[model samples]
Target chain A: MQTGSLEHISDNNGPIIEVQDLVKKFGSFVANDHLNFTVSRGEIFGFLGANGAGKTTAMRILCGLSSPTSGNATIAGFNVYTQTEKIKRNIGYMSQKFSLYDDLTVWENFRFYGGIYGLKTEKIRERTEELLGRLGLQGEKNKILKEIPLGWKQKLAFSVAVIHQPKIVFLDEPTGGVDPITRRQFWEMIHETAKEGITVFVTTHYMDEAEYCDRVSIMVDGKIVALDTPLKLKETYRAASMEDVFLKLARAK
Target chain B: MLLPGSGSATLEGYDVVKDFRKIRDILGYMPGKFSLYQDLTVEENLRFFAGIFKTTPEANYDLVKEIYSQIEPFKTRRAGKLSGGMKQKLALSCALIHKPEVLILDEPTTGVDAVSRKEFWDMLDRLKRKGITILVSTPYMDEAMRCDRVALIQAGKIMDINTPEGIIKNFSSRLWSVRTNDTYELLLDLRRFKATRSAFLFGQHIHLTLVDNAGSEPEIRKFLEDCGHQSVEIEETRPTIEDCFMDLMKG
Candidate 1:
């Protein structure tokens, strides 16, 4: 079956992410070994693998949160090791257990993050209103963070991550326990963000979610064993779906 | 482990060392975090859980042989910093050290990758064939179908408990998938129709649940045309487990 190609790709003048021979270790244990991959601008790149497969390690290195033991990664024309501060400025990250103060209201959390990022109060208010409005959360500005449902908190987390409008966003399992309908809505928002020229790098355990990525890389025992579109990964492994392909590779090792 | 409304006072017919503790034996419990002492090696962690149940890994060596092989390389690593999947495997090994009759896992695959998630389930299948009672919980609907029996819970309430197929069979309507050039308009129009009970977007199509099943294809087509819908494709289909869960929630 032919899948329609994704449009509005942020001009592919150069690769947004480039990694070669990435290696990380703690004492004698190698967390990542000779990892290699590249993600183009405006693409939803999935970093997939089994638990403990070193996917997170590789992501941390690229995001400049951790230094690689060896090898190299460049993001948006900046070296992860040497230009770590610059990379942090141009990246938005939402961790698995993202914190939004329960005591704070929706707009309050937005303003807090904007202040931390040094946005002018006028810009913060303007962007905060525009973003919450876009997410249909205008009326929810005063609602306490703890009172909102899990689905809405997830959307709000994404909105907070991008309040500064970074060039790339890294979402670590952004929809882990959400319902199916809510997940679909979340992906629609992801597509909208990508359309605005932001790269999305997501890590997820849902195989069906892998199908939505522009391209995906599967890590196994600290190595990049497969990298391609979801359809191509299935074809290369002679599996019916991304799940089957994942099982076939993961079990073999 | 007090279940509200169960009316049972306390667990009976089990010994702490014999039957009560036996429940902990044979059963594997892998928490999201490997909870083993960071200062302790993997072998020490396994030995410690075994000691708690008054058994050694060697006592159940034959049963744990296969699992040992899977994690042999990381035996010396500290549990605190083990990889995500390794911690999972080690925890399972510890939980099953005493050979319990039933295993209870609370969201074992929550933080794992897609591949590890599948592998973890495969391991469960292996354990199930050994006649071990495996009771697992997950919030993912896809994982729900894999369980022999599932209890769907929300807000501390048990919504339903049954086989996956049984839950889907209990769905309360004739589900119809309707696709058109304009989904937003179709949703608005369908919601206004008396024949439609509920209409929600599922992927590229809008799933419309008929209220009374009185409308035929031509009748629905005419209704849509009158509502200004164009080139609509409609098909009747069985409900998925998710659909059934949604219905249960709505009811």
Candidate 2:
């Protein structure tokens, strides 16, 4: 619930993420090719591409999950290659497939993730109560995670991802298969989190969600074909919507 | 077999309770989750599914040829090893291999990328042309436009069923798109406005409806300016299917 207090690790004014000529190769196959981008503090950056278009590869490198073959990148002012431990400590990640334990209760899941992030016992308990209260799930805290609705599970996953108050959060298709109203509410939560000065790096299949980003970068065949604001990209491609722009770029042989 | 609930349903003119076995023979179902053997090769899985229907893949090869050919190169690979898009195609191919008259797909494009989602829908359009009654569900509102008719369901209840165009047409409220320098702040301010009935974020702009359509553009603009907001852009835009969905959900 608190905002803008976790700024001791990195300079507040510098770009939260920086990448230059990034490339990841696996046995002669290049998954990410010469990627270059910078994400400023508190900006919502949308990283988009088709499946197997190298978006995941680049995100892995930036999140310090995997080492890139060749590149210069820093996350939260720590080197991706040399300071991967520090980088991991300063960023949070949530994927659609795996973010929480299905068999555990809601409160237990929060306690477990908070423990993994090295939070104190008292702080974890306090934050858990606060989050459940905000989500209006105070009564459901004892319920198993699998029993909750899909929309509620996603919102809880997002809140848990930010429980550590990391400098940047990586969300991989956070709203997949969510209903219309819940999806918009999820974006509202994203805006609120970004307002608290946490940089959001998200990837989604929905093009309309791309319009919500401050800037979007489109990848195709392991290369960034376009990167700009949504309005500018639409105008440059002469497309009516982000969906059209994506089709034009992805299908342009 | 036990009837668990109160409602009675039928599939292809067969009562679901009395003729469940008969319905199963003519129904091709692909669940949202990939429900194939992960250790099995793609080809083996296809053959196994085909065998379940008392048929061989070769018997209905033409029906799945368009989709299967793309993943055929990886026929020997394990089903778990294929990428997201390829796994979807393989599941779809297996579902079609039974030559079922009715096909049901659940959230087939949930996590698929945009390009692959478009391609999958194109494949469905082709399948529809072949006279297969396909009943597919997707969370993406834009995809609703592709269907001849859509039933918006919320919390296990169907809200409305109509064509996408008809659904949009039924939104009788005058919707306005309002944008300003600060979108989040604008949302808060608009919600506080006296005549505003409903306000929600739609991409960069806030889609708003008036309280009984009483507020005009100038009135809303003056209210925003008075609240110390600038660079306001207001336009009366047509409601999208998503807009209608949000409206109906609220009602």
Candidate 3:
């Protein structure tokens, strides 16, 4: 397993994600308008926007799930347009609704996801044990996922997302409707994962979660209107919190 | 909807069991999930709900004027075609169309963007000023502070109930906000630090509570510096509702 400081990761200096003039249009409607940004190797990049501000469209394009109408982009040093398969192999994804199976046991879910990622059966077993041990869920490995608490299920889903040690992971509203304490725990896990050199690109409606990001980009009407550290963004907008900053930017459009 | 339960509750002096019909008439509920007929148009859904409550949309237009006016332009649009914020506004309008004396909203702001969430709460404030009693249940702890009183629930049990300020004031822990250059490393180190009682990351800093008889702030700072963390900053801070809830859950 690759476990070390971010510096130990190969290609530690260059940004893992790079996009230039990315645009995705749905017939007459422009979902992503000239989006351009770069995410560093191990940075926690928070992609925030209103419901129709084009976050999901851009994320889908980056995840190789869809094609952009016009743009240049790359993920993990592979061209998004030409090398989509390589991009898919290098990135992991977990959305709020479709990351795990409720009827599957803890071990089954891990094995299933690992298999999809092309891990060998023996390797899947080893990784499952290690992950379950780290999460203190060894006794519950055989338990069905539906019986687990929402918080633990979310954490386990995240663990399974990174089971193959992808270069980047995309989280779409991963903490929606979770209780307060569990939300913090899930973030701690995110930080731990980022510390292990996996770039985290997450989208969320929670503004406080925006503060946890190394940098945040707020999309307003399919445009990247603001991009900076939480403190810098707060100062730039002269706002007290990220929520206020978001309100000011989103309301402006 | 009846189940074997051991609880007694009332609304407007009507017992939940014996006067369910009366209680049902006077209560407006917007469940957490969007429950409006998806296949119905915006105006049709509103009219359908209004008809069920023995009212007409025109009869109570004043009550829902603020929210309904926002979506009235899209009246012919399907309920499923509206955006999240618009759907919520329509849902709130349907809930208030009957002019019920009491309104119960279940996590109305969940999954909503910050701007829409603020607008929804502002609309609630407007309703409250108009002589309506409002009860809202939300998982967002920050929303708890907006309420007059909040009940912290855990594992299907109510852990504590009080005004937001009162709950924070009663928090019996010496909380501190600790920051360092590497927050992730700082969290790992703090968890292993012998004097640490509890530590969890909150944005850029970790909300920490030291064990009783632990060393002072400077000593802890020194300890962290010795552990190779630079730019360490520690300051005494009061607990928010979330902090209080976590502490109560532990007890």
RMSD of 1: 4.8
Candidates' C-alpha lDDT: 0.79, 0.89, 0.88
**Predicted candidate 3 versus true structure: per-residue lDDT over B81-151, tens digit per residue:** 99888999999999999899999999898888988888888899899999899999987888888899988
Question: If ranked by TM-score, best first, what sequence of candidates would result?
Answer: 3, 2, 1
Query: How far out, in Å, is residue A127 in model 1?
Result: 3.2
Q: What are the interface RMSDs of all the models? A: 4.8, 5.5, 5.0
Best by TM-score: 3
| Docking level of model 2 | medium
Global fold similarity of model 3 (TM-score): 0.95
**Best-first order by lDDT:** 2, 3, 1
Off by over 4 Å in 3: A1-13, B2-4
Which candidate, 2 or 3, would have the higher DockQ against the true structure?
3
Residue A6 Cα positional deviation in candidate 1, in Å, after optimal superposition: 2.0
TM-score of each: 0.80, 0.94, 0.95
Score chain A of each prediction against the true chain A by TM-score and list the results.
Answer: 0.95, 0.93, 0.94
Q: iRMS value of model 1?
A: 4.8
Fnat of every candidate, listed in order: 0.43, 0.71, 0.65
1 or 3, greater by lDDT: 3
Model 3 chain A worst lDDT run, 10 consecutive residues? A1-10
Q: Which candidate ranks first by DockQ, i.e. highest?
A: 3
Runs of candidate 1 with Cα error greater than 4 angstroms are A18-37, A67-73, A102-105, A134-151, A221-223, A235-238, B1-33, B129-131, B174-237
